[model samples]
Target: MNQQNVRNFSIIAHIDHGKSTLADKLILKTGALEQRVFKDQYLDNMDLERERGITIKAQTVRLPYRSQKGDAYTFNMIDTPGHVDFSYEVSRSLAACEGVLLLIDASQGIQAQTIANVNLAMAGNLTIIPVINKVDLPSADPDMVREQLEDILQIDSTEAILASAKQGIGVEEIMEAIVERIPPPEGDPDQPLKALLFDAWYDLYKGVMILVRVVDGHLKEGMTIQMMATGHTFEVEELGAFTPVPKRIDRLSAGEVGFVIAGIKKLDETKIGDTVTEFKNNCDKPLPGYKDVKPMVFSGLYPIDGDQYENLRDALKKLRLNDASFTYEPETSAALGFGFRCGFLGLLHMEIVRERLEREYNVDLLTTAPTVVFHLKPEHGDMVVIDNPSNLKKQDRTDTILEPYLRGTIIVPDEYVGVVMNLARDRRGIQLKMEYLTPKTVMLQYALPFSEIVFDFFDHLKSSTKGYASFDYEFLDFRASDLVKLDILFNGETVDALSMIVHRDKAYYRGRELVKKLKEQIPRQMFEVAIQASIGGKVIARESVKALRKNVLAKCYGGDITRKRKLLEKQKAGKKRMKQIGKVEIPQEAFLAVLRTDVK
Candidate 1:
């Protein structure tokens, strides 16, 4: 295969903007899969992705196409996730491509993620082919979308291809645009082997399989390759590209995208952004790797049964091999026992990881409420980064606390701008800027605390705007805040898993709501169970679960009033003694009470 004939590109778009559908149509048009075997979202192989109707992991495929001029070409397409949570995936995918198909929803036009992804593509200096997708929809206005592409994104909308990915419209034009507009990957095949390891996953039979985009020279079986980052060497046993499925190939040349099986057992050795080169004749310097992804949301993942702790640990380790953005460290809680303090890009990322651990790894996990990283500076100590609220138990030790903030970009209809502003303000967001993208669409910028958006902020935004708003954000900076740790005590003992850091002004209300929710979830015990929410040593709210009444008084119903009084007193004493020694078992629901966003 000639390097000049190979075109490496990726499809990037906002959520529900037809990226996967476009990829499917392209694959089908290329005859990569037979009609009988083809499926919707063919690239999204995971059940979770199919169920959620969103792409989680970026998928790569090789399409063999012939241009109108009758020249055979190999198109390497990486389909990327559109959700803000999976933007890291998009970035890595972009690194593997020389160009990108920037798909914009025809009806929705330019969105927050559209702008974010366009910025990313521009940063990488990749050739972006503007694609107006879903043009066949009843509400679609391709002319309006074209204006948006030109006005907002500064892209030449005259060349923008209007297509319906679902209906297989304009598939040929998209393919032709790839060949005409997107440049062929530039690499020297004669040079020593140098490739970028963009992704990898663990296989039960073949060990770790890595996806790479060759930059210089060729990679083949029996070649000894060393990872530039880890300095680990392995002998490549097999190499192939996915024609929607793994098909073994003799070798991978420069300007190509494919997977390599190197008989590597451990995944950590194959870093996502590491450069791969020949061990004996390696390149002098590694390729510029990807930036390290920092997690936005943190939570505790504990096993339902304590004995499954090791299994959970093993699952996380294996899962991390596939998802490099997800991070975890050993942690323990007084109430939840041994667990891992896990970090995720967002709430959805956390949810997907939890679901994968349970469904794929068969580990039943109990996840704590999500929280963002906080910076705490104590009066007599250096600055510390705290993810768990229980670490803030010594409130007096901290002189000041700083919370992570985000520069949020939200695009909504003009009619919903007021409601969106109110929602942002309610979340402690400070308005940064507001502009009208068009007469009907409004774009808003705000600086919001990361902690404020981790839970139900997206849900609220969608509901408030009637699902008309699209949002994307990036970390701004940490700012000093009046934050306090809200602790929940069950039977007078603080439950570390239920503790959270919140704004001091809302602590009383949140505490009150938390205890009330807990009161409803906590079952009545033999002794009166006290559920209290407190800050430091001061209890702010309390709820009591009454002790289950016994038949001691029922048995003495016919007795004299004095005798009945004596029995009641004795029962009361017994109840007091039980309350002193009895342990209140907080149910799973009680532990999840902190996740209820409507506590107010």
Candidate 2:
């Protein structure tokens, strides 16, 4: 195929705004799949994505189309995830495309993530084609959505196409616009081979399957390619494109998207944003790789069965090949034994990873409470980065604590602005800006601590706004604050996995609430178990789980007073001895008690 006839683009939108659906319609319109074999969310092949109704990974497909003008063209489309946690995936996909179809829901209008993705596409200098989706809905307001495109997005409303992806409407117009508006890739096919590695995954039989967008020259099956970042070379075993399904091709020319199997066993060798070039005739410089993504939330992932530690490690390695954003390191906890301290983009990202590990790898995992990174400046030494609360030292040695903050954006209905503001204020947020996108919709910006956003913030925002609010955020600089490590103790022993860093003022209140929650979760044992929330050496709150009574007195219904007294004394002595050595079994729910409490 001619490079001039190839159009590389992606579909970007807010969650559930019809990105996958639109991709399906385009693929179907091109006769890429038979009607009987076609399915919804055709590009979302992962079971986790299909079950959750969200696209976690970006998927690519090549479409063969003949325009009404009788010219044949090839459409390479990448469908990207919309959730803020998966924004990195969107950025990677955008890097491989020449344009993006910015899909907006007609009924919902603009959202926080929609703006975030638009900024990403703009940053990449890609052509943006505004498409008003779900126009056929009963409550859809395409006219209002068009006004939003003009006012909020600063895009020409007249050029915006209104269509319903679910009903297969305006598929032809979208295809035509993609061809006419998006410029063809400019690359010399005669030049040396140079391609950008956007994504890669581990394969059982084929080893590492890398997805690349050719920028300069051609890549063939027998060519030897080098990863400029790793300086490793390998002979390409296979070259192909996914026309909804994998199709073998003799050569992938410049300005094309395809996969390459090079018998590379380790995924680390094929970096996400590295440059792939010919070994003997490589380009002068490598393409600038993607910025490293820092994880926001950290938690401990321990196998329920301790022997599966190796299995868990293997599972995490394989998962990392698919998701380059999350990170993990070997860690040990006194209560949970050996585990990996995992970092994720957000809570949802953490949940998805845990689920994939459990379902796909058949490993039962015990996940601890999520926490954000904090910078602690010791009075005697240098600043230390702390991800786990258990790492915090005594307050006397710490001069100051700095916590990460976020520049958060929330879009909601005008009527819910007051409630949303109250929610932010409760989370110690400082208002940055607020404006009306229209007479009915409002956009709010705030500077919030990353710790507050990690737990229940989204849940609270949705509940307070009646599920009308859409929120997104980016990391800002860390700021000094009055923070302390709140620890949970069972039977007078501290549980490392249950500790967390919190603001000093709220520590006492949260301590009381946490102890109460843990009391409910900790079952009664043979000996009375004491649950305490403490700071340093001082206990702020405490609760007791009463020991299970055996009723020695019940067996002495007709006994004398002396006999009853002797029996009671024996029971007390036995309980005292048992409390000295008996261990209190803390359930998994007890470790999650921190999340159930009102930390604010």
TM-score of each model, in listed order: 0.97, 0.97
Per-residue alpha-carbon lDDT of model 1 for 1-600, expressed as tens digits?
Answer: 988999999999999999998998999899999999998999999999999999999999999999999999999999999999999999999998999999988999999999999999999999999889998889999989988887899998898998999998888999999999899999899999899999989999999999999999999999999999999999999999999889999999999999999999986788889999999999879999889999989999999999999999888988998999989999988787899999999989999999999999999888888889999888887999998888875777448999999999999999998899888988899999999988999999999999888878888899888899999999999999999898888888988888999999989999999899989998899888888999987999999998899877776648579998888899899989988888787777876777784832
Top candidate, metric lDDT:
2
Q: Each model's C-alpha lDDT?
A: 0.91, 0.92
Error of 1 at 274 (Å): 1.0
TM-score of 1: 0.97
lDDT of 1 at 267: 62
lDDT for residue 243 in candidate 1, whole number 0-100: 97
Clash pairs (backbone) in predicted model 2 = none
